[model samples]
Target: MTEVRSTPTQRVAPEEPPPSDPVAAAWTDYLAAARQLDGVRRGAATAAGEQARSVQAAREELTVVRARLAAQQSRLRERGVPAMALVPSPPEVTVAARSMAAGPAAVLTALRTARECADAADGVLDARGWVAVVGVWRASRPEGWPDRLRNLLVYGPLAVLGPVLQVVLVLTGSGARIALAVLLGLVLPAVAFAVGWVGVGRFFRPGPDGRLDRTPRFGVLVCGVPAALCTAGILVAVLTG
Candidate 1:
């Protein structure tokens, strides 16, 4: 038997690869994509972590400042001084600083000049002037956020109805349309007043200073007045038509 096998020893060739190892290719491709996705996820996570840390730091700093302010306020109260009276007004720097001989007379003169300047500044910052300043401040502030989202909840169906009313009035034939138009015409200003008052609170919310500063009333005037005028124009058009 050993001799017969030794006479002819033919080696079998290795098997060829499959036509297309699609499953293998797919697995390799999936692994490559997974690697890329993991890299992206890691990068995003790092960025989000950095932003979170920054926000936390700012919040901590604000808390410290608030605590300090509260302590100062308590101290002021303990001294029996009215808190409003003790709150320091902004510093007044004079244009002219004359070198005076160190004396009581010089001190008195300096005090009088400073007081006069303060009075003038105060006169400039009355209600109307302050309203103008608030307008300018509000103008510079960013917008385009959803306003009084809670109001949307409270007004619910009415909010839906308000738009629907307009749509219905628009669709109806002339006479009924005119009636609906007139109703909306009267309702709009009161709606505006309510909305504006609610909106003002968002603008006047506690800023850096804990005091309540008036929000820009200008937004109301800017948006509401024009809307009212447009409604009136529509009414006029309807009447004329």
Candidate 2:
């Protein structure tokens, strides 16, 4: 007993508690599954929304492309192109189908490309139309007619109309009618000037560059001068005769 050594006391780590009740464990599993299902639903909804937007955009693009193509086809037909020549070839149809095979996004891209091509074609056609119109204008007018002279051709007629009517009234009618003609002389020239300004901008304004047809000063003079002269001449004739 005296030779026996004292042994040191060893500490034991405590064991973890046993698994929770089966019902509680099952409830926890159910909650995890429900959360995962909810997440999946949200993801699917997001994808669907994106798909719907893409589809709508593609449909709009298709409509625009179809309208442009139809217009171009009509224009080609008007320009003496055979209907058969305007139809897409089998290879072209196949190529177009292949381009849109990737899905709605691809279809949208193809439609946008087609729209740009249609716009370029429109520009070329418009340029050609302008050239034809300019050629006709040159042929109709005297060569070397300045912008002012060309514009005057349009403005001059409108300007003279009021004065001519006033002169006619003066020659045919007396006192009250003459007074009416005189009053109209003041009003009509301003009206004529406004009409000519609009007409010049609408019909005769040059090209895609958007230059003004002629100076407003020139138009004002062309429109106003005739009326003023006719009014003066009418007064002189009335006083003398």
- Give candidate 2 misplaced runs (Cα > 4 Å): 1-4, 7-13, 144-241
RMSD of each: 32.2, 12.1
Please report, in order, the local distance difference test score of every candidate based on alpha carbons.
0.56, 0.86
| Residue 124's lDDT in candidate 1 | 49
What value does the lDDT take at residue 200 in candidate 2? 71
What 10-residue stretch in candidate 1 is worst by lDDT?
92-101
Can you write out model 2's per-residue Cα lDDT over 110-213, one digit (the tens) per residue? 98999999999999999999999998987776333677887787789999999989987887778988987888889888899899888777766464465665
Report the CA-based lDDT of candidate 2 relative to the real structure: 0.86
lDDT of 1 by residue, 94-166 (tens): 3223422333344445555545655454464455457878888876553322334423332333334444455
Evaluated with TM-score, which candidate comes out highest? 2
